[model samples]
Target: MTLPLPRQRRTLGRTGLQVSPIGLGCSGFWGHRRFAEGAAGRVLATALEQGVNLLDTGHNYSGFNAEPRLGRLLAPLLATCPREQLVISSKGGTLTGQAGLGGTEQRDFSPAAITASCEASLRNLRLEYLDIYQLHGIGEHQITDELLGTLQRLRERGLFRHLGINTHSRGTLDWLAANPTVFDVVLLDYNLLQQDRAAHVAQLHEAGMGVLAGTVLAQGHLLPYRPRLPALSDAWYLARAWLKPSSRRLMRSASKMRRAVASIASQAPAQTAFAYVLQHPGIAAGIVGTTRTESLLQILATDPCLLDAADRARLVAVFGDGRGSPSV
Candidate 1:
């Protein structure tokens, strides 16, 4: 049931950079049932042909395989497309290593580690500069002065065009406010299922920072409720299954509420979920990731004309002021 890739573009926050509304997530290339290397390259090619200009990867993804693979695939294409036209982004703040029978692991962040991470990413990406270099996860303990200093130095050295933090916590936003002008973008997990930080998102946007929404599908719990087989072992899937009966009941109730809302919204359940975020004034781009190229295309193809008042009301009713458990 894969849909055709849609053609859509939006301005990436204050950078004035325009890219496809739907960006490709490279993390999918890692972990279980990894996509074949050749198939991965083809996915990028297909995405490019379909007008997806923004590609995201991280140093820790796929035990450091994602960036190099993406570099190999996009290097040749760079000559064909203007460098400024593509929004290539990668993140730091985490270290990855091979752990046993094809397993992977990661380490936390530090100032020295940030520099080293960017250097390694630069080499793996085969690029002199990155359009966006993000700090992967900035929990309270990780956001230190040294870490901020390191990122500033990287920008001073022209290693990256823009710098930002990728986090879902309010603490990260607080850190950004403390260190003004240190970041140009912020990638956070925000969706209808989790809206606890919607006000924070608005605050960041008001502060002249770009907002990139990730995990818009609430880790695939929204719409159609297709459960992958047990062997998949995806964290979100497992978490949903393990939730207490009360939580599960709430989740099921929320899902049913969302379905009803979608029915009245005249959009597919998935599209409705995405549109919920798209309608947010603060969001500059939505980062949707899929290993399946067809799924990626489907995300891009859906036309999110503005969500109407009834749609907004329905969302509020189901998700309740867009906050708490149902807002992921």
Candidate 2:
């Protein structure tokens, strides 16, 4: 099937890289038990064909299944697309074992382990250099001289063009952003519920570092709170959370918020969530993970400009304006 390409492209902060406003986050490409390889490849091919240049993945996602699956799709594309035409980003720091399922993961940021991780990734990806190489999930203490020196050495060897950090911690993100010379990009979880990092994202962008928003869908909490589309991850989470009253309350609150967003935007809750993240002025790209082409197409079809002055105000009122009220 022929798909229309997205016309929008934004600068990835000061990296001088231009990418589609929305990039495919590939953590669940084949890591999620629900995603098959053929479907994952189709979604990827569709995204790339539509001018979405940024592809985000990590070594530990899907228990090490994610990167190799991505590499398989990319290998064929490399035959036609020039290496520089695509912006591939991958992270490391966590090591997985046995199968792609969780349970036996361990953190290893030692210089030797990091070096080995990059070399292994290169072999898996069948590529000479990555566009963006990030430190997976490191705390401030992990930012030692040894780690920084190792990243620099990797860069000098042409292993990657730019350095970035993908952290769940706002303090680490802020610290790295403050030291702009060490990192070129920042990827963090930012959604309505986790707006604590929103201002930091804008701050980093202003400091001339690319900021990519992850978990924009709030781990599917922002997806349409409907019955037919239950998520496997959500089900597993809810099973554990259901036992606790506080977790139940949080789930109920999230459901109400989703419904409210749908009513306010006169759009599907998922579409509204995608629109919300893409409209952020400082966000270079909002990374979305999907296993199906239909889901990807829906996101690609969303017009970031769909939200107007009043819609923006309503969203801010509903979700709070901690991330600023700039329209995209």
TM-score of each: 0.82, 0.86
Candidate 2 ranges with C-alpha deviation above 4 Å: 1-5, 32-34, 97-105, 229-253, 321-328
Q: Compose the digit string of candidate 1's lDDT tens values, residues 42-110.
A: 677777777777888888776678888888777887766667767889998766433332322355677
Query: Ten residues in a row with the worst lDDT in model 2?
Result: 96-105
Cα lDDT tens digits for candidate 2, 116-228: 99888887778898899999878877899989899899999999999999877766976876787678998887766555466787888888999998877766666664567
Worst 10 residues of 1 by lDDT: 96-105
Give all candidates' CA lDDT scores.
Answer: 0.70, 0.74
Q: Give the local distance difference test score of model 1.
A: 0.70
**What are the clashing pairs of model 1?**
6-300, 6-301, 192-327, 193-326, 193-327, 193-328, 194-327, 194-328
The TM-score that candidate 1 achieves is: 0.82
